[model samples]
Target chain A: MELLVFLIFAFLAVAAALVVVAHKNPVYSTMALVFTLFSVAVLFILLGAPFIGVLQVLIYTGAIVVLFLFVIMLLNIGREDSQIAGHKAQLFFALLGAVSFGSLVILALSSLRPKVLAPLTPELVSLKALASTLFNEFLLPFEIIGLLLTVAVIGATVAARRPTAEESAATAAERSIETKEARP
Target chain B: MNVDVVVTVAKIAVVLGLLLQVAPIMVWVERRGSAMMQDRPGPNRLGPFGLFQALADAVKFLFKEDVTPAAADKPLYLMAPALALLPAFTTSVVIPWGPNFTWDGKEYAFTVSNADTGVLLFLALASLGVYSLVMAGYASNNKFSLLGSIRASAQLISYELAMTVAVLAVIIPVGSFHLTDVVAYQRTNTWNCLLQPFGFLVFCIAAFAETNRLPFDLPEAESELVAGFHTEYSAMRFAAFFQAEYTSMAALSALGCTLFLGGWSLPWLNYEGMGWLGVALGLGTLLAKVGVCMFVFVWVRWTFPRFRYDQLMRLGWKFLLPVALLNLIAVSAMTLAGWL
Candidate 1:
């Protein structure tokens, strides 16, 4: 039963990822990305990491993908804009890069010892256990990441702040001059 | 094993049937209830006191033409309604309706899936509910629909933060993400609402927004957006959106009851260890609580005027989010200090 579930979701994930890249419309691609994220989340649940699985759906599909769709629609990127500008050479290089990455992953897996792994016990993936480990063992890295995110948010706010009064007035004056020039 | 499978199947059928039936009935209730509040008669001609009005509406919707606009994205236009409906059905699976009861010397739970990660699953599914509106709006190839969907996405995203924080506040006292555990915790102590009134208020407001009920129904503000995201939808597709909204309302009510109103537990009564009778009574209590919550939903809809778009955004971000965060911190502190 577990294997069947895993296979189904794995197939779905790969298929959806393909659709994400192959779809002509950016909106379709974004929707396909949501599908891929959901399938991957199911795979996470199957692996006994239900918290992580839910987080994947919550953060990626629910939040990030919605933001992606928002930006896509906000910019009104039509089918013409969605089309890739490159030719056969770009496709060839992309395929080569993908093949090399696959081979590298395969090689890494093959080098690992062929020993029977311990089965997932409920305690191993329980929320309490996961929380404890995350807070205790990985506390430093977690806090650092949190700090980095705060810094990034601050930087973004500063970057996107409104122009100064002088700057805005100057821009308004320039726009009026351009409009007057065009009126003639 | 066969009996277990049969029982499980039967349970699923019954729960789903109840949910599907209740959503339409709730629609009727909302209409009638709103009419009563406004001192006007509403939908009295369809059936006895207009009870079967929803059924008639369903029949009408089924026969209506399923129109797909020429400029609309065909596949997405078709899929949006189903996407909208799926989360409501899926999220209900984890809600425990009653306590376990022994039948023929075998114990069975009232819930479909009593997973430990129930609360998280509910939140995850509820968050995905945004997709339906977004897809519908974007696919319609209409400006109003697109604007409505953008509002919906923004509204949902903003309100979800406050909702999650409020839920976290409730979780602190219970110290468990499982709905059953939360209920069980409340069985001995007071309801979370009594303990965390601010959290409950925040959650209730956020739930209203989450379900897109008035006065938070800015996404479908008819005065401006002309029916919002479903402007281009017709026939069963439109019905699907309608049904999904009611189902989410039901789901959120059930969730709120479970989290803050003590689920199936009645005050000053022990329903456990009494077998089938207890199970039945527990289920009744939970349903009654949910029904009351549903009534409150209707009452609030008729009483409050819809918020302006900017006002709605400000209320969610500036007001609710900070209060919810503070509630979370206070609850956490109390829990750590052994005060809760």
Candidate 2:
């Protein structure tokens, strides 16, 4: 049953990934990306990472992709504008990159010993265990990453701050003068 | 089939039926409830006391023309309503509607799927609920719809952070994410609402925003956005969004009940070990709690005016988020001190 479920979702994930790249409309591509994310989430759940799986859907599909869709809608980019400028070259490079990545992954996996590993027990994937490992064993790295994220957020806010009052007024006057000049 | 499988199937059927039935009942309740508050008769033209008003509305929606706008994204437009409705209906699977009952020498839980990750699953599905609104707005190809969708995404994302923190506050004390375990903890101790009152308040406010109820309902501000993200939807498609809204309202109420209201447990009353009677009483208690919460939802909608977009954002981020974080810290400290 698990194998069957995995097969179905794996197929869906690949199909969705293909659609994400192949679809002409950006909105449709984004929707396909959602499907890919969802299928990957299901695969995670099947692999006994329920928490990660749910987080995948929660954070990626739910939050990140929604923002992507929001921007896509806000901009309302036409199909012609969204299409790749160098379509053939881009596809060729993408295929070459994918093949190299696949081969690299296969080589890495092949280097590992083919010993039979213990089955993933429920306790191993449980949130309690995951939380303990994350907080206790990897606390320093986690805290550092969190601090880095906070710094990044602060930097972004500072960078995106609105223009000062005088600058805004000057720009407004300039825009008004331009409009007035063009009106005739 | 095993008894577990059979029981689960039965539970799923019952839960789905109850959810489906509640949507219509809520529609009637909202109409009549609002009318009472407004001192006006509403929807009384249908069956006796307008009890059949929801049914009539359903029939009307079914018969109305399903118009697909020329400029709209056809597939996404058609898919949006169902997408919106899916999360609301599916999120109820984890809520324990009643205590376990021993029948035919086997214990059966009332919930459809009592997974260990129940709380996380609920949160995930609830977050995904935004997709429906966003898709509906964008696919409609209307400025109002797009604005509404944008508001919805922003509002939902902001409030969800506070909601998650508040839930974490409850979870810290219970030390579990399973809905049944949370209820079990409350059964032995005080309800989380009494323990974490501020967290409960934040959660309630966040729930209001998350479900897009009044005051925080900037996405669907009829006066401003003309029905918001669903501006272009009509007929049953429109009804689907309506059903999804009420269903999520019910689901959120159920979550609140489970987390803070001691679920099916009545205060000072132990319903366990009494077999079928206990289960029945527990189910009734849970239903009553959910009903009260739903009534509060409807009451707030009519009593309070909608907040400005800025105020809504301020309430979510500046006020609720900070307070919720503080509540979490306090709760965590208390738990660590072994006071909880």
As a whole number from 0 to 100, the lDDT of residue A102 in candidate 2 is 100
Where does candidate 1 stray beyond 4 Å? A87-117, A163-184
**TM-score, per-candidate, Cα-based:** 0.91, 0.92
Candidate 1 similarity to native, TM-score: 0.91
Tens digit per residue, CA lDDT, model 2, B1-340: 6777778788889888889988899999999999999999999988899999999888999999999999998888999999988999999999998888876788777788877788989999889899889889988989999999988988888899899999989999788888999999998898988988999999999999999999888999999999999999999999999999999999999999999999999778988878878988998999899999999999999999999999999899899999999999999999999999
The DockQ figures for the candidates are 0.57, 0.55
Tell me the tens digit of each residue's lDDT in model 1 across B37-65: 99999989987999999998989999999
lDDT of 1 at A76: 88
lDDT of 1 by residue, A118-168 (tens): 787898889999999989999999999999999998999899999999999
For candidate 1, what is the DockQ-based docking class?
A: medium
**Regions of candidate 2 where Cα sits further than 4 Å from its true position:** A87-111, A163-184
